[model samples]
Target: MESHILAISGGGFSVEEKAFIDEYLLKIPRKQEPLKIGFIATASNDAQGYIDEFYTAFKTEQPSHLTSKDFEALNIQEVVNALDIVYVGGGNTQYMLEIWQKTRFDIVLKNAYQNGVILAGISAGAMCWFETCYSENEEEYEEFKGLGILKGSLCPHYNDEQRRIAFDNWATTQKNNILYTLEDNENLHFKNEKVVAKIRT
Candidate 1:
């Protein structure tokens, strides 16, 4: 089975600026009818507004929002197994990872990926899939370890000078490692841990 990941630095459902990118995401799954997509809003603390936005964006698909509450009430593995795509929203990356780990949703996600689920997201969501990533915390940019599904480091929002500088400094230490720097409108599509396409919107 091939694992697919579309990591967008910015400009997805939340921004609603680049519809084509989202269209590309929706088309990745081979399932044509009843293509189930799960929206993970943990990064935003399950913000209702964000969830509503997702619903508005993919109303035809009838995507389901996977919240922290669902982690306790539902069988995570089963829920993940039912989806063709898992799209994570952006916010606090560290907090999101902590929640995912505590709930063992990370394990479920890994299994889902291995089973050929399309994993895609933007900003904090995009950064969470790599071995390491540059993220902003309390106004300061820093490096943090990621889920390790994808090799190398990812720095989202590279258009920001501070983040770019911080990532550049961190990159110096990670010599020989592949580092992905993405601007607000850029995206990288990976299959089996290899980048197959560089997209701009």
Candidate 2:
């Protein structure tokens, strides 16, 4: 199996972006037909609002995610294996990581990537794939440890996030850091932890 991941800069979801995202998942080589994609809203604590938005943007019906099943009932690995793609929603990265760790999804997701399942997300979703990431936090700014599915740190919503009062000295203050920034409508494509600039859209 090959490893492929995409970390997207989050903005309001749209049809064009949805088309691009779906295209990415469909293009990935898979022996399976009628690929099954799952959405993770752990970042938003599986918020129903975000879940509804995701389905709306993807132009589909809602799917079960922690709401229909006990959190403990979830077999993260099994669920991941049954799917071709896992799309995560944006929210508090730290909180999301904690839940995933407690549920052992941290390990399951790594296995999914190794199994050639496409992992993609935006904002907190995008940032989770790296060693570090920027977040749309309230009150104060904080750093977070990513899944290390890909190389370097990630700063999503670059253009939108810069307007926040807290992201000062963003360009020059952070030195000796491997950080990648993406504005809305842009994407980063990775193969085996190495980024392919040519495929970026």
Highest-TM-score candidate: 1
Please provide, for model 1 over 95-126, each residue's C-alpha lDDT reduced to its tens digit, 9 standing for 90 to 100.
Answer: 89889889888888899999888999988889
Error of 2 at 36 (Å): 0.7
Each prediction's TM-score versus the true structure: 0.95, 0.80
lDDT of 2 by residue, 40-123 (tens): 888777788877766666554223344323345657578776677778878788888878877777888898888878887877
lDDT of 2: 0.68
Worst window of 10 by summed lDDT in candidate 1: 11-20
At residue 189, what lDDT does model 1 achieve? 96
TM-score of 1: 0.95
Clashing pairs in 2: none
- Distance from true location, Cα of 139 in model 1, Å: 2.7
At residue 71, what lDDT does model 2 achieve?
A: 40
